[model samples]
Target: MTLTESSQSLDELLKPRRLFRRLIAVIADLRLAIILLLSIALFSISGTVIEQGESVAFYQQNYPEDPALFGFLSWKWILILGLNHVYSTWWFLSLLVLFGSSLIACTFTRQLPALKVAQRWKFYQEPRQFQKLSLSTELKTESSSSLIAQLEKKGYKIYQENQAIYARKGIIGKIGPIVVHVAIIVILAGSIWGALSGFLAQEMVPSGATFGIKNIIEKGLVAASPLTKNWLVKVNRFWIDYTPDGKVDQFYSDLSVVDKEGAELDHKIIHVNKPLRYDGVTFYQTDWGIAGVAVQINNSPVFLLPMAQLSSKGSSRIWGTWIPTKPDLSEGVSLLAKDLQGTMLVYDKEGNLTSAVRPGIPLEINGVTLKVKDLIGSTGLQIKSDPGIPFVYTGFALLMLGVMMSYVSHSQIWILQANECLYIGGKTNRAQVSFEREFLQIIEEINEAQTPTLSVANEIKN
Candidate 1:
C-alpha cells in the first residue's frame, strides 16, 4: 500500500471514539491546552499585526517588493483558512467545537461514573469499613439492640447488624462537575456565535439628518442596505460637556427611530454607556459635532451671488439683474460680456478688453492682483449597531448561571434513631470537609442527648 493509503488506514482505525478520546486527553493535558492557547494567541496577533479589509491594490502598492511574502500572509491565505480574521478562523472555531465535544465526552466517561457512585445511598459497611472511616467513633453500651433502637428513633434507617452498621446521607452531590462542564459549553457556544453574527458599530446622526444601516459595517452575510432604508434614524439634538482644559467630560445625543414604513417607534436620549435600544438596534453616544468651512476671496468680503448683480452693498459689493453693468464706466474698465466666470471688461476704458475674471483666481488689472484670501475647514462624529447582542448576552448569563450551579451543590442530613445506637452521616456535592464537620456536630448532639444525666451530675459536683 502507498504511504497515503497507510495513513488513511491508520486514521480509520482511530475514528470517532478514538478521536474523541484523543481530543479529551489533549484538553485534559495541561501541556496540550497551553499549546492550543498559545497557538490561538499567536494567530490573534496576526489579526492585530496586519491591517484588515484592504483592497488587493492597496497591499500591492504597500508591499510591491515582497509580493510573495505579502500574499502568503494576507487575505490570500486568510480567505482559504479564515485566518485573516483569527477569531472567525475555521480551524480556531473547530478547535473550540472540538474542545466542547471533548468536555462532553470526558463528562460522560469519567464524571458520569463518579456521579453514579455518589448517587448511591447504599454503602457497604462492615466493622472494618466503619473502623477505617475518617470519622469513625466507638460506643460501648450494655445493650446493642437498645442503642440501635435509639439510633432508629433519631431517624437513621439501619441496614445490616451484629458487629457494625451502615448508612448514607445526601446522595445527589455528584452533579456539580456535570453542571459546570455543560455550562462551559454553553458559554463557549454563545461567545462564538456573538463573534460571528453579532454586529457592533456606530453612526453619527446630525441634527435633522436621517440615515440607515449603510453606516454599519456588514459582516458575515448581512446585506448591504442603503443609508436610508435600513432604519430612518434622526438626531434631534446633541450636546457635550467639557472641562476647563477643553477635555470632554460627557456627551449625549437625542435620537428618534423611524421604521422602513416611516412609522415612528420611540424617541430617546442616549449618553455614554447609557445607550438607547430599539428593535434590536442600539444607539450609543459615541461622538457629536458640526462641520463647515468659512470662505473668502478677493480684497472684498466674498459672498455668493447669481450671474447678475442686483444691488450693491458697502459700495464695493454689487448685485443686479437684466441690465448688464459696464465695469469700464465705473472703474475705467470697458465691459464686453458677462458669463458665469465673471464680468468681461477691458482696461483703459475702451482699449483691448481682457478675458473674464473668475471668483477665486487672481487677475492682473492695472498692476493689481486679486487673489482668494481664505478658505477655513469642521466637526466629526463616530457611531454603531448590533442586533444579536441580546442573544449573546443571554447566552453569557446562562453560562455564568450554569457554571455556578455546577460548582456549588446542596447536601444535608437528618438524624434519627433505629435501635439505640446513634447513626450520624451527611452528604453534599461540594465541600466534603464542611459536610463532615456538620456530621461531627450531629454526632456530638447525639452524645449530649444520651449523656444529659452524666452532665447534670458533673455540674452538681462542680
Candidate 2:
C-alpha cells in the first residue's frame, strides 16, 4: 500500500474511537448529571402542583385564559405542553432515560475504575512512597512483624512483601456510590414502567348491585383493560357510622368477588384507609352517597325514587328526590338529605318548608300521607393497579443499604522497614481525625513492644 493510502485508512479507523470517547466524556460529565437532576426535580414539582386527569371543562373553568393561574398557566398551555400528565409525557420519560444513561456512564468511567484501583494491592516498596502519605513518621525500629500483628488487630486486610506491608479496610465504601447510582436508575426505570402500565378507575355502585369496571378516568398508554377480569364485583351493602352530633364518622362497604356463575370467591368489608387487593387490582373506599329513597303514597305500592346530587359549596354533600303527592302529578314534595343518618327536609311544590321526616316515618305533606320506608346508599370506590410497585420497593431497599455503606470510611496504611528505620503512614477517605488517633495508638503499641526480653532474644540470636 502507498504511504498516503495507509495514512487515510488509519485516520478512518481513529474516527470511530474519537467519537466514542467524546460520547463517553459527555455522558460522564458532572455538570450534565446535575442539570438533568435539576430538570427532573423541577418537572416533578410542576406535576405535583397541577391537578391531573380532569375534563376539559374543569380545566377551562379553573385555569381560565383571560386571568390565567399564576399569570402564565392556562388551559390552552396546559394541554399544549401536556403538563396535565407530565410524568407520562414522552419528553419527561426521555429526560429520565438520558439521566439514567449519564449515571451508567459515570459508574463505568469513574466509580468502577476507582473501586478497582482501591482493591489493587500496591506495596509501598520505597521509603519515599511512605512520605507521600498525609500522615507519616520515621521510628528507629527493626521488627516489622510486631507492626503487622498490631495492624491485624485493628481489622486491616494485610498484604506483605519482602520488606513492605500494605493494609486496607472499608473497601465496601468504594462500592457504595456505584450502588447508589444503580438504585436511583432502577427507581427511575420503575417509575417509567409504572406510568406506562398502570391504571386508575373510579366507580359509584349502589348497594346490592353487581358491576364491572368501566369508568376509567386515567390510564397508562399500554395498560391492560381492567374489564378483562374473569370475576365480577358486587356491593352487598353500604352504610355509614355517625358521630354523636349526627355527622359522618366513617363509612364502609361490604364487597364480594363473584365468578360468572354468581358463586362468591372472596368477600371483605372495606373502609377508608383499608383497601382490598385482588388479582393485582386494589379497591379503596373513597366516598358514600344516597342512592335513592323508597316511599309509599296512601294505599299505593312502594316505589323507589332515584336521588340526584345537588351542587353545593365546600365539602358537604346533599341528595334530593321528588315524589308525587297526587295521582294527577299536579303536586309533589321534595325530600333533601345531607347524610345517611335517616333525617330529611321535606319541602312542598310551592317552595314552602313542610316538615322533617325520617325512615319508617309516616308524614302528612301536601294533603297526602307519605311514608318513607328506607334510604338506599351507594359506595364510591377508587381502583388502581400497578405492575412496577415491586421494582420501586426493591430500589428503595437498595438505596437505604447503599446510603449506610457510603458512611463507612475507607482507610489504608503502608509500612516499610529500610536500613533500621521503620517508615509508616496511613490515610483515610473520611473521618480523618479518627484515623489519625488510630494510627497514633498503633505506633504507641509498637513502641511499647520493644521490651528487654525482646533485646535478650536478639542477643541470643547474635
lDDT (Cα) of model 2: 0.91
Q: What TM-score against the true fold does each predicted structure earn?
A: 0.58, 0.94
lDDT of 2 by residue, 1-462 (tens): 999999999999999999999999999999999999999999999999888776788889889998998899999999999988888889999999999999999999999999999999888888888767999998887888888899899899999888888899999999999889989988988888888999888999999999999999878889999889899999999999989988889999999999988999889999999998888889999988899999999878999999999998978989998999988989899999998888899998887888999998899777778999999999999988888787889899999999999989999999888989999999999999999999999988888887775788899999
Scored by CA lDDT, what does every candidate get? 0.52, 0.91
lDDT of 1 by residue, 1-462 (tens): 999999999889879878777766766664654565577567768778765544556655554545555455543554555544566556777766766666666677777988786555444233343444345554433234544455465455555444444544333335656766676667567656655654544454445556665544434334233342356777666666667755568776777887878677789877878877765556666544332111232354553322233243444332222211233434433322222123333335445646554435666654444432222111123333434455556656766665555655455332233344333344555677875775666566556655875679699999
**Between which residue pairs do clashes occur in model 2?**
none
- Return the TM-score for candidate 2, rounded to 2 decimals: 0.94
Superposed model 1: Cα runs more than 4 Å off: 1-85, 141-173, 200-205, 216-218, 221-230, 293-388, 402-436, 452-462
Q: Number of the top candidate by lDDT?
A: 2
Q: Residue 363 CA error for candidate 1 (Å)?
A: 23
